[model samples]
Target: MQTYPTGVAAKATGTPLTTLQRYLQRSHITLQPCDVPSRGCGENRGYSQRRIIQIALTTELARLGIGPSRAAKAAFEFSDKGNTGRPVGELYPLGQTLLVGLPDGKSVVINIPPDKSISDVLSNDSAAFICDCGYVVAKVLSNLSKS
Candidate 1:
């Protein structure tokens, strides 16, 4: 597993440095500890690729007006649900769009058979929101590489 420093992780996850700092302070997220802790202020801790993805998804939830803490919790649950091997981004087909239930703060990835659209399964006025896993994963990976 590749581990990224704070600045790189923040950039990779599209999370602001201060926001990551706040989460670390409250123990919402922890770094994959290093041999020598302090390389500098932002580089003191190292975050894993998994952690970066978690942060990125949390921001996805936050866009729905959910606060950071709640979003982080939901993201954590979604990412590591049941200690499952695959994370959220790869839970379904790479480009699959997931229908997220906001009420319970859980996500369900239903396999969309070929020739069927996601809209075919749910009504238009659904309280649920759709998430494009492919886009999210690509964005995070692309940024992670750049950073």
Candidate 2:
């Protein structure tokens, strides 16, 4: 198994330390005390390599606009349902326009003004669906990285 210190993981993944903490907290990954003290701190707390990867993947998902809750849910779902089957399509009726796409494909919408954000047209459920899609994509990327 590959191992990485928290600092190294943060640097490699381009994730802030605080964001990593939030993801770890949300994901409920286990951690351990560091054998060596960190710089400018007397405490010795460190995250495991698996935890770092999990946090990094979560951060990347959230960066794509998926919130922590949905990210965790989607990550769990993807882990259980490996991407070996055909894609699933979903349609979102946003006001007068309709957006349609497969879960892992780019969305196509019709009759929406170019200046408006998609969030403006979507209801809370639709927004959540979009967030879940982002998380699924992140999970796929994470799995690819492991191979």
Which stretch of 10 consecutive residues in model 2 shows the poorest summed lDDT?
A: 86-95
Candidate with top lDDT is 1
TM-scores, one per candidate: 0.70, 0.39
lDDT by residue for model 1 (7-123), tens:
887888777889878877886765433212456655566676667777887777678776777667656654545323344435554335453555555555444555777767654
Alpha carbon lDDT of residue 13, candidate 2?
56
| 1-147: candidate 2 lDDT, tens digit per residue | 344556666665567888766766765433434223246666545544434444554555567676666554443332222222312222123222332232553333322335675655453323233333333334534643654
CA deviation > 4 Å runs, candidate 2: 27-51, 76-147
For model 1, the superposed segments whose C-alpha errors exceed 4 Å read 30-43, 82-91, 94-99, 109-114, 120-128
